[model samples]
Target: MAWVVAGVVCVLYFAGTARPGYLLVRDFVTVPDPVLGAAALGRDGAAPRAVPLDAITAVLDPVVPAALQQRLLLVGSVLLLGAGVGMLVRSRGWPAVVTATVVATWNPYVVERLLLGQAPTLLGVAALPWLVIACRPGPYRSQLARALLAALPAALTPFGSVLAVATLALVTTATSGARRAAAVALPSLILCVPWVVPALAGAPTRSAAQGADAFAARQDSGLGLVGSVLTWGGIWAPGAHLSSRAEVVPMLAALALVLVVAASAILAVRGGGRRAAALVLAWSVPPVLVLALATPVGLSVMEVLQQVPGLALFRDTHRLLGVSVVGGAVLAGLLVARTTRSLSPPAVTAAVALIVSVVVTTVPDGPRRLHAAYTPVAFPSEWADAVSSVPAESRHVLVLPWQAIRPPLPGGRVPFLDPVPRALEPPTVTSRDLVVRRADGPVLVPEGEPEIRLDDPTQARRALDSRQIDVVWWWGVPESEPPPGFVTVHDGSQITVWRRGGDPRSQLPRGILRPSTD
Candidate 1:
């Protein structure tokens, strides 16, 4: 039953991926073979957002094809997520299981995150239901062990790791005492060492100056910030969510569902499963707290929190709403179970089917929207050729048109984070600052990634002389020619590779500062 629900959701959401091509959308970039460089280890001077996820991919490149691994991870994450939700409510009966599975997988949060290409983070989120079950009251040692084991998947990304610890702390405390919660929390936190160590060791002095506002949850629908989040639809990225979410009608339907689930959760506490229902309700607090922090006064509070090392990672508060999905699904399952007790089996089946259909079609043409948006793309041949053109001695490869997010590739509409750093052998340097386009104007997220400054010719020359950046892979047409010290080695229609010449002290040409065509 869980597999069926998962399959339906996956087919609806990612059917286009069945065709041969890479799932390159937004920040979701996959390479055939990722380079196991300093950046992958989070030793790069930038933030550790990719962290151990990149390192894990590089390590698995030998045993599994990167593309296949990615497909498996993405699809499998959804499957496991549905299955875990199903397992949580299986004791309630098949109807409960089905309701929980559908509600968990077929929601705005999952859809938005999938479209945004956050497979790793989603994978971590998939473990939440299982973590809840594992933390159930039992022998302290056995419960602690199962809880830690369940948390391993969420530890894949830094955000996921934090979420895992939070979930464990809450659930373990609910079932056991605070002392047991501490026991579980300490070990679960230790699991984050892969990212935490690298982040603390080499993270930049200045994190993103404007990231709090840039990544804060925005009102996607007619519902303002709080209302939008209640419906699980407020994402920072405009295009990342289902287009239907912008409509007042669908958002209203979603809000009604939220109210129904809340009422059902209260009934669940009074009827039975009080602890479970309360815990589910408790899960809503984190997201609400996050939304509170997103407010103007809350952002002022966040400013102080950002001063603490590594706290900046949670700037994107919407992602923290993931646990809310689990809560909503389980509570919805309880609603289905408690309401349908006296109904005939055939009527129950019909009722469940109608509910499922309504839940799916609420966002009209969702599957088609995903299919059209998720077209697979093959990497351009020039990209590989450009990397191969660089000399073996070049230690650092810098991608030009220094946008943190690359402009759309040929035949593609979605722009993604530059894949050059992962594709190349050398440690690659690119802009960490994200440029977000808004109706008003362009907002620059000054995320500090220490790189050669194009504005300061002397600084750029010094970086070249010191071999901090030995090769430049410029994509698209530059406003001006390469400065005297950069000799073009391979110039293709789209990609041009430049290596440092013997004379590194030459002055940079004025034309080098012009805005990139990208």
Candidate 2:
């Protein structure tokens, strides 16, 4: 059953595969930056993000044939998910387990989420069933497998780890022994050390612990919130999606599935007072809280909650929808098993297969369009040459465009992609700052991330000196030449590089920091 669903999902994923071109949209950028490594380890920023996926990406590096990278991840993830769901319903026999597998793998929302590049969160989703298994009364061998299963998602993100832990707590497990809890938790901690230690250090991303705007549901109303969960719209991040087009059929499908899940869980809980059924319903709390935050009262409550560290890790509330989907599938499986028990084996098989086919086929072809967005770009030789020319000790070059700021974007201020920050090597500081234009003028405010505004030569140089910037790499041809004492090293069609006093590491008098009023 798992194999059948896994094969179908893999085919669906690869259907969109294209080389050198697969890298399209913000989600697909393959920039080379090492600061993320530092950030992941909790060394630099006050609010550093968890980057388990980034670590895997770094390991895959230039060796893994850049074009195939996302494909590999996409395929591996869906297969693991299919298998995990299959194992969860394995005791249910043919029709029930098969139906659950289809429900889990027939993930239309997952396509949109993947397009938005929620890879780390998706890994948590895939790890869910295994996390549930770890909570069940089981032998040491099965418990060991549970530990390993718990580790994958735990290593991915804080959100995933919390879900894993919460599930162990919420579900009415027969096993009360601390041994089972210990088995699940111990490996999770060991596996997630790279992220856990840094996050524990009390660093926060600039936007960390911020607000409901970043954390709440994209859709405000209860129905809209429910629909968003059905269609996987919670992340509210930038990505091309069919739901954005108001496609009626998909919207209706989402609403229907939500009903099916709700009804199934209700029936299961009422019928036998099942712990698993209750657990799935409990999973809805996070998304529900996000929806509640749409109101002024809820926003006030969330602000108070923000005082606790790691609480906002799930700010992009859509990440938690994976658990809800899993719960729906589990309950749906139970309903199928009970209602169809009277049918002959062959008849049940045909009926369930037909149902699975209809559900999968009707799903919007969002991933296919996403696959069309694939566009792989080779790293420019000019940037490579510039990096090589710098003195060995030189660290964190500041680019000419000081930071990525924008005119207007739906999610927030994102710089135009001409010279994205990720293109530079580690120790390089580019900007991820939020910028806004005041009604009165052309000035841009530094809203979130730390940024240095160097709109002119002297100010730019002073900003450089204050921070002890090593190299200044500019891609655009500014009307004015660089400041005095700066020696031009390489001026080519792609970029112009300058070394101050023949060294990117040169020092000048200590100066005031770049004024915010600039």
Candidate 3:
């Protein structure tokens, strides 16, 4: 039943995928065929942000279109959240399970992350409840395998890996013994090796201290920053939030809903849920503290913490809040079950209505968000021919305009990362720098990943001068004059491919290579 509810939510949430063209928003760029190269292996003088995900997509490219693959994964993630939460509190009864499913699936955190084009990170968030259930006090022989299976998707990104491993270690140790916990944690550690190896081997990408201040949680309503974070709605990106969150009535009602949920949490803890409550409390403290300290009042605290090695991973801090969310869902299920058993029919209906109203208020325009965030982008048909025309031996294709994020193109309504790198056959060099527009002004965030910025013609010539780039694919508006002494191979309306003299050896490390096909 919970699975059925989840399926409906996914259908409604991602209705935009059914529209024509690819869904290009922020970091969510999917190409039919991705070039597997040094960057895929985290050897391109930068951090392994995509890492194993790119490699996994390349391996599956022959079987499934990358765009469809992403859609399936995203839908599967929501299902995982619903079913996992339902299963965890199944003992509570059907009403509790269903209510928990709706609560967990339709919250501000999930919606905001979706709008931000971060389905990959949500995998780990979805997996947390399941990991808890799998690691519960048990003597089963297949515990290790079950635990690892649940953790696989979460292992795709570093942040996800952290959440998965932490859940495994804590839950297993608390319910079972430390020995069993260690047994499960070992393989979870092994699962993270794909990204861990590259991060350790590659030149370390320096994390900016200013990012702590920049990405701090913002106050979304009259409820303020703490209230906004408590409701799991305050993402730093204004565009990512639902506009309804700005209203007073909805926020107050949302606050009432939070108080009721808090009461439920207390009831659950007092009634034999102490172990689960303890785990949730432990997980909540760090994220809440970090998020609070990232604000203006605690800027000094953040500055001190920012100097700590590897602290860059938690600069956003809000990502870790999923633990509390999952825990809260479990508690909420207990609340529903208890109410159903003791309260009158009228009371139960009112309770259910409260949950539904809060969700509706949180994302008042669900379909609109879907349409806006997943706006279809039609790449020129000539892109295929232009990229194929590049010499097979060419090392890097330097894409021009040198910027990362782009405003709405001819057929698109949302901003997106340049898709040339993923769409083209050869490995491409494009900007990783992100320009985030804030209320004050636009701030150019230099790529934390250690990639060379071809921000100007001088930089482009330098890359060409070094004889590292054999092809220059200029797409969209021309940012500057094309590098000198290069012959134009394909000059179509949308893309123009340029080839320089001589085949230069690739200075960047190489990964697995696949044959190019239409």
* Cα lDDT for residue 107, candidate 2: 62
Say which candidate scores most in lDDT: 1
TM-score of 1: 0.92
Model 3 lDDT tens row, 294-322 = 66777656655555434454566767667
What tens-digit string does per-residue lDDT give for candidate 1 at 1-518?
87788888887777777877676777677776677876777765667787788888889989987787778888877888999989988899989999889888888888888778787778888999889899998987898889988988788889888888988997887788799999889877887898777666643624655666777788777777787788777888776767787676677668767876788767766776657666556557756876887788887766665545577777778887778887888888878988889999999999788777666754665677667666777777777777788765677877776566766666566778787777666666676766565546566666554645543456656666676777878877565676667788888888888887766654444434333211
Badly placed stretches (over 4 Å) of model 1 are 138-145, 202-205, 272-274, 391-393, 439-441, 449-462, 465-467, 477-481, 509-518
For candidate 2, write residues 174-204 as lDDT tens digits. 4545655665555545555655565555524
Clashes of 1: 0
Per-model TM against the reference: 0.92, 0.78, 0.89
RMSD of each: 2.5, 5.8, 5.4
After the best TM-score superposition of candidate 1, give how far the Cα of residue 287 lies from its true spot, in angstroms.
4.0
Model 2 global lDDT (CA atoms, 0 to 1): 0.55
Best by TM-score: 1
Error of 1 at 128 (Å): 0.3
What is the Å distance of residue 33 in model 2 from its true position?
A: 9.8
